[model samples]
Each structure stands twice: as C-alpha cells, then as structure tokens.
Target: MTDHTTTPPFDAADHLPDELIERIRARAARHDAENTFPHDDLDDLRSAGYLGILVPQDRGGAGLGVAEAAILQQRLAGASPATALAVNMHLVWTGVAKVLRDRGIDDLAFVQEGAAAGEVFAFGISEAGNDLVLFGSDTDAAPLPDGGYAFTGTKIFTSLSPAWTHLGLHGLDTSSPDGPRLVYAFVPRSAESEGTIEVRDDWDTLGMRATQSRTTVLSGAVAPADRVVRFVPPGPNPDPLVFGIFSVFEVLLASVYTGIARRALDVAVATAGARTSKKTGKTYAQDPDIRWHIADMALAYDALPPQIASLAADVDALADHGARWFSLLAGLKHRATATAKRVVDDAMLVAGGSSYFTRSELSRLYRDVLAGAFHPSDPESAHATLASAWLGPIES
Candidate 1:
C-alpha cells in the first residue's frame, strides 16, 4: 500500500485521473481493515494537490470552485467513501476561505495560504448533544489579552485529527465584558505551546473506518490573535461563514454519497451481468426482476449529480437564494445520503452472498452511507428547515 516510487503530478482535472483514483482505491481497504487513517491516501492526494483545490491559482493552487470539487469528490467516493469523507473536512476550510475572499473578506486568507502551503485544516464544529448544529456551540472561547481566543471543549468527529495543522472551530465567549460572542477561529498545531488538542483513538465504528475521525479534546487550545477570524452574536444570524460552511460542506458531502450511489448502481449492473440464474440458465442481467431493480436504483440515483453540480455552481457564482439557500443546500445533502443508502441496499441484494461479506465494498458502503444520515442538517433538522422555508417559522 505504500508504493511511493513515482506517480502522477498534482494537475487534477474536473474529474481526477482514473489511475490515481485506483491507486488511492487500492489503499482504502487496507486502511479500513486496520481502522487506521489513510496516510498513504492522504499523501497521494497531497502530491496531486487535492488539498489545495480551493486555493486561488494566484496562490499556487488549483483555484477551483465547489462545483468542480463536487465532481472530483464523486469520482473519489466511487473508489473510497472514507477517503472522500476525510478529505471533505479539509475542503470545508479552503472552500470557506474561498467564499470569504470572493466576498472581499480576507480574514481567512491565512487558511487558503496554509492549504496551498500543504497544511491540512480540519472542521472542528461538532460537539456532543449540540444539536443546534452551527447555530450554537458548547465550546468556550475565552478572550485573551493579546486579542486571541482560547478554546476549551470536546469536539467530536474531528476528521483528519492526526494530520490536520489547523482546526476551524467556533466557540461561545460568554465571559466577555460586553456580551456573549461566538468566535470563529483557526487554531493551529503550534498552539501546543499554550495548550493541546488531544485526539482520542476512538473512531471504531460500523464503517468509513479509514477516515479515523476521532474525538478531540481541546485543553485550552489557543487560537492566536491573528488566527481569530469572526466575532459574532450567537444563534442563527446571517453570516457568510455560516453560508459558506453549510453550502460547501453539504454540497461536497452530497457529492460523496452520490458517488456512492453511482458505484453501487454500477456494481449492481456488473453483478447482474456476471451472475447466472440457477432457475432459467440465464444471467441475472437477463432477468426482468434484476433489470427492474437496477433500473430502480438508477432512477433514484440519477437526479442527485445534476442537483449537486448545479447548486455547487450556484454557490461558486454567489447566487442569492436568500433564506432559501439553507433549505436547498441541506436538502441536497439529505436526499443524496438517503438515496445512497437505498441504492446500496439494493445493490447488496443484487450481489447476494458476496456483498454480505463484511469485507465487500458494498457492505462497507452500506455502513458508511449510514453516517451521512448523522451529519449536520440531518433528516429532522432538514425537514424543519424546509418547512420553515415554505411555511414560515413555526407558530411561536
């Protein structure tokens, strides 16, 4: 899995090169088998400049938008969902930086520069029982005299924990002289001098094992004055950081699961073609039932890629959906993940006993796809968001 003699350079297209994807794909199962982070996968992607895909070309990076990133993610996820998911955490930061810079908010320029300079950034917003999602945080952001902030909270599901150089996080600073301020900041590993980020080796789960998105314990992890980016009132106000994170994260996440659906559909088709029916002496592909199941899978899977692509492009172009954007973006993530689960189930049935094996890719996908349902803007929250969009806020 560590074949690093030579490989492709970092000039990825709209879709990643198939050979490189296959190389990353080859390492996926081993990483998952060991419940380890895909270090080789990360190294290969880094060599291909994938981590800097959102950095501006002027900054010695790809300068691509979320739309292009979504396409590439779909391709990557077809091979490895865990890899895609881990990479998604990094992309969120660069994508946010791009959104900020595009709107003339240079506060996150350091994040972009860091990405281009080969620094891995992790999304550190998740907290236990914090269902308010991005609207609030349990993390404490204590303001420092030098203008920086110190974060003390347990952030769960910190993807790329072992490798990330910066963690983009938000915390509530209630002890401020004025009022509670939700500070959004990037805490670098250098903060080990002042504090430490303790990453627990506790990511054992049903699937996506290769992600190694372990729990993080921030013991006064400090975001220096220069790294402190946003200071805002908490609880669901209008902010570009909010929009950028939701838009980029949901869109890219949807792309990953959409690719899962695509791969499942393709695998089902392949299985149908190769497996012969014991009853009719014909291939499963010839059976009307199998064809219909495959068709149903395709039907469910078809609408997502176009939806992901269009909405991602809209985000890049800065299209104004106003209050509707959250619903639209979150809705895409909800639908894609849900659809991928259904498609994977169907494909597993199509593959029969082989797919039932725990090591089978479809089996892994079945478990990995379930995680999407657990991400932000989950089904219940997504429905609430949509209902609020269509019918106005709840009666209160």
Candidate 2:
C-alpha cells in the first residue's frame, strides 16, 4: 500500500487515494484465482472518479492529461496488473476522446460526457491476423438508410466485456460512396443492447486472468447514425482517430508493463535483502553479483517512467512530432515491454527457486509481462517503424 497518498510517483493529490489502491490489490489475487473480473475494483474506481480521469473537467472529471494518467496507471499496475490492464481499455477510449476534443474536434464529446456520467468504454480494435492494426479492419460496417451502420465481425481480446457500457470500434466500409472507407463508431452494450455486443465466456489464460478480456462476437451490432464518428479512406489516413487511439493505447499499455517492472524490481530487492547466503554467512544483498543484478534492474526500470512522462506530456501539449510521434510512441511501448520482460527475468533469477513456483507473485508477474509484447505496435512493427524513422520508409 506504500501510502500512495503521500508518496505518489506524481502529485496526484487526493485523486488516487491510498486506501482505494490497497483494496484493489487485496482483491487482485482472489479475482485471479476465481478467473473473474474485478467488478469491485471497477466499482471503487468508478466511484472515486477514476474511470473519468481523462474525461473533460468541464464534464465533471479530473481532466488530467496522458502524463498524469500514465503515473496513475503505473502506480495501479504495481499493485494489480490485471486490474490496471483491464481498466487500460477504458482509459484508452476516454484518452482518445480527450485527445480529439483538445484538437477542436467535438465528435467524441459523447465519449467524454458518457465517461463522466459513468459509462464504461472498451476498446474493440484488435482482430485476428490483422497486423495492419489501425490501418485496416476485418469488421464490416454496412451502411444504413438512416446513416447508421451495422457492424458484423468478431472483436478479440475485448477487455471489460462483462461491464462496458460502450464499445469503441472501427470497420471497413467497402461499398461507401467514397469507396473503401474505414468507419469508426461506438456500440452500446446494455441489457436491451445484448445482441449488438455479445460477450463470449472464453477468457481463460496464463497471466492477467482477472482482466477477463473475452472474445466479443458482434453479430450485426449497430452504431447509430449519431454514434458514427469517422469515415476516412483506408490505409494509413493520418486521421485523429488513428493518432489518438495509437498514442493513448501504446503509451498507457507501456505504462502498465513498466509498473510491472517496478514491482518486480522491488520484490527482487526485498528478497535479496532478506535471503541470507549459506555460502558466505551473509545476506544475498551483500553479494556483489546480487547487488549488480539489482542495480541492473534499477537501471533498466528507471529509464521508462521519464520516457512515458515526457512523451505523454508531448501528447498533452499536442506537440507536432510529425511522422516521428508514431515511431517514438511505438518505440516507447516496445522498450517498456522489453524492459519489463528483462527486469522480471532478472528478478526471477535473483529470487532463485522460490519464484519458479506457480503461486509466487514473481511467477504471476512473469506471465503478465509476457502479454506486453503481444499488444499493438508489436516488436516487429516497432522495429520497422523505428527503421523507417532512422533511415526511410522501405523504398516506396
């Protein structure tokens, strides 16, 4: 519980109270054990106005930017990665809305207002074999007479499936007047809106089990005419939707994994200090090699928070990084995930056989960190992006 109110990574004030985080941490293992969503955590967060951290202050939220949100998420993830990961989807959408609104685009105003009013949003962008990421989609957005759309496709790894009030998604509209438009919109998931957003019970996995990010099947889900937000031509149309989602998603995602690294390092340090070596009749912490490992873990973990904060602040300032923002953000994500994996591995080794057990916290962290590599802007994509930035886009 670290008295987060006083010792927060950022001066979060009274927003991220210490008690709320402790309660969230207490339930994480149980939720992981039961293979269930941390509804109570969500409830506490919702009540504490966490779900609306990115919603506009004018709209009854804290009205913070991505930098502060990154700090909050890192703190939360250090306590409970699954809860932080599950909530990341919601923050991504709200952050997207904030990014758009800051750019003088009022289209996603509904998202901000909805979030402030307690509407939960889940990101529904990832599709199987769709490495094109935001640049493409397998979902079909069939146009309607009333200007709405009927989206028919499966959205995988949709976190907060069991409780999301709105699902933000995009689909390819090939038959549009503009021809091959990538339509983006939000689909509701009320009881009356069941068929529109079906939550499939198929989220059994290794780490981050409590996220319950089930496979969502959209059997002709409808996003009303008003809900229809963008209709840009496909294949990297540099739209706000693209930039907003990409920046927020990758940044927040990176923040979560970085926090995992922080926790892992802390655990390793504690274990090292406590475990006395039988060989030298001294503590492992006193061993030069062990101290070196801890030093390496700190060295690796320290670089990420500043990077996240700096880039996130750039996002808040709406800094024009031109084509560089993509590579920078993607690189930050890639680095964070990679660093997290490396730190966790070092920590596991430093902890010795105790960490090998399935029930160990380090073991849980090992599995959770594995997922960081699988998120958007993956390793290969990030390298390609970075290469293009350093050299040039692959010869047309």
Candidate 3:
C-alpha cells in the first residue's frame, strides 16, 4: 500500500478538523461506556455542514459527490464508527431523494430541506428473519382508501432511529400480491400520525453501541401517498444493480472500518512507545515482531482506500446503465466489508490485551469495526449474487 503520510498539499476536505477529531476520540470512549448515541459529535457535524455534504446545491446542500462523502465518513469512522454508521444513512437517503427530485417527485422537498438543515434520517430496512438482506425489509404497505398506504411491520437495525426527523422506509406493497412491488416512503418522525411507529430501544450489540440500531415497529401507520417517492419495479432495476448502489454501501462501510483500523493502529503505536513488556525491560514496540504487526496494519489500512476509489470511479462512469452499475456496486461493497473486518481484527490482535480493556481505544475500535461485516450489504449475499451472475444461464 502507498504511504501518503508524507504527501503534502493534500486537500483539506479529505481530512477532518483537529477539534472534531478530538471530540470524536473523546466521544467514542464516552458513548461506548454509556452505550448511548453521540449527540455532541453529531452536532459538530451538523454545524460544519458535513451532514449535507452530498446534497445538491439547489436543495440547500454543498453538492459534493460520493468521493467526498466517503472521505468524510472514513475520517469520522476512525474517530467513532457508530456515529459514522448512524450518520452515513442520511447521505444515502439524500442521494435517494436527489434521484426522486430528478424524476419529478418534488413533494419530497421537505425531506430534502430537513436533510440540508442537518436533521438526522434513519434507514428502516433489515428485518429479524430477512437473512441479512439489507434492502429486503419485511415491512408491508397496503393501499389505503385515501390514496395513501398503511405500513405495518417490524424493521430491525434502524441506525439513528432514536433522534431523527425522518425515516426512509422500504417495504412491499401487499395490495398487489402477485409480484414484488417495492415502495419507498419518507415518514416524518415527529408527526402525531406516526405515533404508531414505535422505536424500540433494544439495540444492544457487540459493536456500534451508539448507533441506536433499535427495532422500529410500524402498525397501521398511514403515510401520505404523496410521500411515496419511488416505487421500484419487481425483479431488477438496472440502476441499483449496475451503479453499484449496494457495492457503494459496502465500499463506504469499508471506509468506516478502515478508519477504525487506522485509529486502532494509532493507539497501538502510541501505547507501544510507552508500554514496557513484563518479562523484558524493553518497550513492547521495540520488538521486531511488534513493529512488523504495525507495518501490516498500516498496509491493510492504506490498501483499502484506493480499491474503493477505483470502484467508485467505475460506478460514476456507469451512470447510464443503472443495473450493471448496481451489480458491480454490490460486488464492491462485499469485498470492502470483508476486507475491513479483517483489517480491524488484525488491529485488535496487534493491540493485544491492551485492546481488551475498557481504558484502551482499541477496545471500542475492535467492537465498532466488526459491525461493518454485518452491515446491509452482507458479504455472503454479495458473493452469492456475484456467483449467480457468473454461473447462471445467460439471458436469451
């Protein structure tokens, strides 16, 4: 992996502020200990316009692209993976909203405005028995008498559900029982009508404790039909497949994992410098073996970004064929997620028993980075889909 550490003239946007970084460092420990969401750090992101970095300028946003967004998320994940995981959903939803706007669905202006203003938005996908399909939510929406729909089902792992103004829900339309009619809706979290949508504060996990990835149960929750922004046709939409939407998620998630790895490496290096081995009177870092582990950790962390960047560039070029792009995207996400898990796992090993203690930052990094493996675009499904594409019968 290339070492850009000595490279000068790096773009400032590619890095985060020292204060924010410090806050993330401090908050990572505090949030993990308290097992609560990182509200303070989120406020910093909002004030810095980082939350709306990907929103279009017309929608009162900075209009940044995926590359920039990925960079911001990577840096933030290094500080706190849970916060990064929780917040990145907003950008994903904003991107979806932008697509809706381009398709002439202007009724979602409120959501766009709220996103631009830094309002948190949770993604309601992933069900208990869905077998780790992130987008394969079990929630169902049935057409109502007033041209709207009544949504009812339980959505699990809804990151950022505890404090968010909006929710991007993906469900099937039961009214048309013949085939899968995927529907997307933007529900206002604060609305009285949405009271039926209960947020379950039961997101106790091995990592990403601050994500508030609790269960959200929607029981006959009526959402305006106008709020239905997009209805994805059953089977495959080439855009989601080709544009690498799933792959992008994987890549983005990998970025977060890399960040965690990076932080773990940093803490390890710092600790090694000061920590003396119990048997030998020498510093633990002085050992050649310890140095090699650090080198390997650095290599893994450095190798990930370029791979993701290359895939993203490919994705950007395939904007015309959404299906091909989405398929490729899925592949990318799969690779990155698995790679990230390995990198962080190695980081934890390198850190040794020090990482096991609550006082060590590596402890939290170890926990937070593991979540990437199980994030929406699971590695197993990605591989299965890729395998199907390779071995399945070719379309006539």
Model 1 over residues 1-396: C-alpha lDDT tens digits?
111212223334433677888888788778877889888888888888888989999987898888878878888998899999999999988999898888888888888888888899999999999998788899999889999888999999999978988899999999978888889998888744488888898999888888888899888899999999888788887798888888899999998898888888888898899999899999999998888999999889878878887898899898888888989988999999999999999999889999988778788878889898999889999999899988999786
| Per-model C-alpha RMSD | 4.2, 2.0, 3.6
Q: For candidate 3, write residues 39-124 as lDDT tens digits.
A: 88788888887777667888788776566566667778877888888887776776555544554545557667888887877777
- Per-candidate Cα lDDT values, in order, are 0.86, 0.89, 0.69
**Model 2 per-residue lDDT tens digits across residues 147-175:** 98989999899999888989999999989
- In order of appearance, the predictions have TM-scores of 0.95, 0.96, 0.87
For candidate 2, the clash count comes to 0
lDDT, model 1, position 209: 86
Report the backbone clash tally of model 1: 0
lDDT of 3 at 53: 68
Q: Ten consecutive residues with minimal summed lDDT in candidate 3?
A: 1-10
Predicted structure 1, TM vs. truth: 0.95
lDDT of 3 at 188: 71
